[model samples]
Target: MDKLLSIVIPSYNAEKFLDNVLGELVKCHNLNRLDIMVINDGSTDQTAEIGQKYQDSYPGSVRLISKENGGYGSTINTGIAQANGRYFKVVDADDWLDSKNLDRFVGLLKRTETDLILTPFWAFNDKNHHKHIPEIKPDDISWGQKYYLKEQGICPVPSMHTYTLRTKLLQENEIQLDEHAYYVDIEYILYPIPYVKTFEFVNIPLYNYRVNQDNQSISMTNMRKNQQQHSLVVDHVNSYIKEHADGLNPNQQELMVNRLSRMIATQLKIIDLAPIQMATKHELSSFYRKVKDKYYFEPKDINLPMRWLIKSRFNLFPVIHYLAILKMQLVHY
Candidate 1:
């Protein structure tokens, strides 16, 4: 029998969380419509072994693919290629879905025939994280306005794992992951918005996104490559906005500039503060120059310290970073 849904989990050193996540997923009572694929992206640990075990235990329902490390984009592309289900979802190895809401989401997609179904998610802040907030209102929202109202609790971060996209829509649009580490969620979700025939947002938080100190997310660490990836993501988004600007009216354009500025500023912040080596400073500077002209907000608009960091990237960065570190040490001591 053909499957109704294909859940793709890209795993690499996810042994700590893979077992529990898969365990919860298989326990779904109405899994008759669901199929699973775990792409073991060169796991140096027992992730592949555990995935193989699940494949053995669940026979037809689960399958594992072993491949050399090709980053997340390749893993997702491989999973999409192998999926035979009518709909596809990309679930990160670290995150898990709420069993109760997962069923509801799938059922809604099946019945409503929407091109995409988006559900809200909670961010588990490993660094003094706060309580989860709900975003959906009864009022109808256009796809473009979602970002501007994020601060007012109306905008949502796409839980790439939580969304259920019609397989045909993805295949038709040829929407795939990019060579980015941090903003794959943004890129995938944003690229599909202009083409979506219909979209529905469920207020229920169906996924728990863990933001731990040890996590590889950009905000958690200061890796130079992550910073570069973010810069590339910003450029991609800018191009999208430019290409589709005609679709947005005046007010929407202003809102877009505001949202895009805030987003670009955040990415620049990562690049400016990253503990990057002097050798890679030019890449960061080059990216900053490319997007610097496009932002609605200028350097003076930002807070003083951030302004200093962005304006003085080449020379004063090391001095500022060291002083900030010293200041923190003094306070802690």
Candidate 2:
């Protein structure tokens, strides 16, 4: 029998948290309907052992794929290739799903054929045990209604946690992400947009995203260390938009542009917070030139700081960099 949902957990040296993640999944009522693929990306720790233990216990639902260390994107690509389920989701090894809502979420997937499914997710802080939901869903949209993307005025881009794409859609489109790269989560979100004509929003918070880990990629220190990878992702997104945006319907085009604009703003902020180095300044200059040359459509609602940087031709970068440092210190303090 075909499983209803494929949950791919990409793990690397995650022995500390893999137990909790898989433990939560085993609590779901519809275990038979869930195809859990735990991709152990060459963990030097006990990650593979834990995964094998679970697969031994729950042979029907849990399968472990032990492969060499490919980055996060490669695990996802492998999952897509091997998926036996109708719908697909990627859950990080450090994160777990809301098992309480799994049954309902699975039931919905069993019935609907929407190209994309969106659900609210909790941003959990492990240090303080605080959790909150970000308002990524648009307020104007009705929950649980399947709407065509071309008809919807504007839609917010779903984060990786919120997205559940059709397995067939991903495989059929050959939607491969950049291997051995940080920040390819943005690519996972963007590559499917042109094909995603229908989407449904579910209000249930299905994904519990663990945050505040120092080693996490989104952390300031790691982001600064891997700024070049982030820049590479930004370049890929810009190229994608330049090639594909024109072919989309007006509403879809607006949605793509909105997502691109936000990404540009984020890249600028990353550059601002980075140490004042010649390389950082060069990245800033290169980014502006790329945006100017590639983005034919005027991005909507450019933020104040970004506007200032652009207007001044980025000469005020030192001021912005210092201000960003002060803001970070104040937040941490």
Candidate 3:
């Protein structure tokens, strides 16, 4: 019953954050039941030193895995494969969880056997002190409630930052994240659906995602530069939907396609960002056409454009995308 939650912290040049994050984690009420794996991802900073210190201090609870730089997704893959606990979660180097919520979650862990655990996370910028728990409301999912993926009524899918999957289930499915990639977190959030049997929503805000960090992939500048990587994830997910929809039941297929639809919509919006070069714009146009054509086969609940206004490659895209963005902003699509 104890030693249930394994938190994988991927640290690459995070000397500034190791002490505070590890310090807070080790002070949790159920420290004995926690397995904290700190992956030193080829860090040239003092991260390894600090990780070793904690490993020595809490010999059984904390362990450090030193590996070459393989980017964030690889670190998660390594950590998941090596986790000693039953439930698994990935906490960023810069983010920390609430200590009280950690205790409460530990309590719930002792009671529930849900395959996927959804919880609220505080999304905020620490510098400005603005924070809010993103509400999962379609008037369906209640906090601290239990439901299956095939459950009736749609609920907002929780972000990877606030989810804990069963370590055994993940390992059984052989979930391999894309190496050296950004936006792989979305892949993690969605790829586990085929295996998940039950889910429980823990309403307490447990995760603190510190936004506005440097080198962040979410910024418009980085998104423009790494837009292809974003597209790579969308392609992988959409491919799964296209190939595997037949094996699932009706409820499972509906949930899977709708969740994937939102993801495609989001990536389409990302592709529509401004200041892109002509070459990349042309590539995006082709990519969009391919994805839209693929989705055309199973267009049950997908809410994309009836017709994209691409006269030629990269030629009417900017104006068309501006209109799409404007429409989305005004109509909440």
Candidate 4:
């Protein structure tokens, strides 16, 4: 029988959580419809062993792929190549799905023809034990109803963690993310925009996105260290939006604009957290000027430090970043 969904689990030294991840999935009523592919990306630990055990138990339903470490994007690239299911989803090794929502989500999958499926995801703060659902008002858009982004109202941008793209679309475009780099997830989400003609919103918060891990890509310290990789993705996305601007429909164009807005805001926060010397204010000024010149957002319109930073003509770079970091402490970038 053909599978409905290929849930790719990108694993690396994830043995601590791999069993729990598989254990929860195995409990799902629609397990038969799931192709659970665990990419053991150079796990020196027991991740491969545990994944093998599950594969042995579940046969084709669950499987493991071993490879040299090429980072998160490489594992996903491998999964896309191996997946045989109709729909594709990327689940981090440390993150797991909601078992109760599995059956209904799978049922939706069996009937969905939309190119993009957006669901809500929970940001589970590991240190604080607080859970946050990234807001997407499903009521604004009809469920299972196919529509172009312009005609329907979707909460501007959806997280990669909560989306499941059609396998055919990804493979057709040869969607390859930059391997061995952090922050490639944004590229994964934005690069596919031009190809996404139809979309569906599933209201369920199905993905449990574990947050606050010290070494996690989104962490402040990691983002500072991986700033080069971060810049790579930012530059790629900036150019991508420019290249596709006229090609996108009104709705698609708005969506892209909103997405870029959020992306720019996040980039500002990342820059704020970076250890830039006050003497090297030129670096911050140069970045600010380029982004401001690239997009036309009224500097005074939005209630963010970036707005003021944009308006200041780079003179306030040091003071602005100091203010931005204070807000970053409360919000997840």
Q: Highest TM-score, which number? A: 2
Better of 2 and 3 by lDDT: 2
The CA lDDT of each predicted structure is 0.66, 0.85, 0.77, 0.80
Error of 2 at 92 (Å): 0.4
Measured against the true structure, the TM-scores of the candidates, in listed sequence, are: 0.73, 0.93, 0.86, 0.90
lDDT of 4 by residue, 82-112 (tens): 9989999998878889988988899888777
Say which candidate scores most in lDDT. 2
RMSD of each: 6.0, 2.2, 3.9, 2.5
lDDT of 3 by residue, 1-333 (tens): 468999999999999988988998998989999999999999999999999999999988999899999989899999989987889999999889888889889888888889988788887765576777777544666777777666643444657877899999889888888889888897788677777878777777788888765467876568768877887877787777666676665555666667676666556556767555686476666666786677622334444352343334446567766775566434310
Output the worst ten-in-a-row residue range by lDDT, candidate 4. Answer: 296-305
lDDT ranking from best to worst?
2, 4, 3, 1
The candidate with the higher lDDT, 3 or 4, is 4
Candidates ranked by TM-score, best first? 2, 4, 3, 1
lDDT of 1 by residue, 1-333 (tens): 667788888899889999877887887765767788999989899999999999999878788899988778778778777787787888888877777876776575465556666667766664665536444433546432232222222233344645777777777767767742656666665665555555556565667666544545643355344766766766777787687777754443443455456566566555545575774467457756776776444454344555676667756666655654454334311
Q: Quick one: how many clashes does candidate 2 have? A: 0
lDDT of 2 by residue, 158-263 (tens): 6889999999999998998888999899888878888888988888889998877778786677767888888788788778877786678877677767777777
Clashes of 4: 1
Q: Alpha carbon lDDT of residue 254, candidate 1?
A: 46
